[model samples]
Target: MVDEVKETTVHELIASPFVGAYLVLRPGSPRGLKIPRDKYLQLGRKAADDVCPAWLVEATRRCWNLDISGRGVNDAVVVRTESPYGYGRASYGLNLGCNYDREHCYSTSA
Candidate 1:
């Protein structure tokens, strides 16, 4: 029998990182984030069970890349996107590498 599925919010979805390293680079992360293992596991299991849509999973995975470093997990990601107001969204993407095109080789905010 399928387990009863609970609806998770975008914030909750945003918070789950430690279920397993199926995609996330960090192990023991979900628990580390203080998310209950059972819940995290349940969520992961649900995702695996196809109750969660594949495109959503893939899209979410593709949307961001977590940066795990010696300093520990850097969940700070910055993405450049336009808001409905036409102003750029302040943040929401993974910061990867440096922009050589720019004069200063600063870390990419996103």
Candidate 2:
């Protein structure tokens, strides 16, 4: 018997960063932005298992320095990219690093 390892996908890499991470998806905007992990991951998972647009996969590859073939993701990542459309409607700007849990926020929108 041989031991096999699981190759992390671009989706998985991006998803690991956690919510409220300051990420910059370039080619669209140079500024880093805090993403709403709840909503972003929802769409990301859909794209990974259900239907992923080409743009998203490509951007993921570039962002993580992985091949476009989708073989797997790399341990090291690339910050800049020629295309950032794969991120969909992700907002751009540096995140303040606050973990905002919708269920645990303990406050309604004021």
Best-fitting candidate, scored by lDDT: 2
Task: Go through the candidates in order and give each one's C-alpha lDDT.
Answer: 0.31, 0.39
Would you list the clashing residue pairs of candidate 1?
18-30, 77-93, 78-93, 79-92, 79-93
lDDT for 96 in candidate 2 is: 36
Error of 1 at 39 (Å): 0.6
Off by over 4 Å in 1: 1-12, 18-33, 47-110
Best by TM-score: 2
- Residue-wise C-alpha lDDT for candidate 2, range 1-110, written one tens digit per residue: 99998985333333323233524343333333344545344433453224433544665666655344533223222322223333322322224345554442446756
Per-residue lDDT over 11-85 for candidate 1, one digit per residue giving the tens place of the 0 to 100 score = 212333321212222232332123344433444444222343343344445544332221111122111222344
Number of backbone collisions per candidate: 5, 4
The true-versus-predicted C-alpha distance at residue 65 of model 1, in Å, is 26
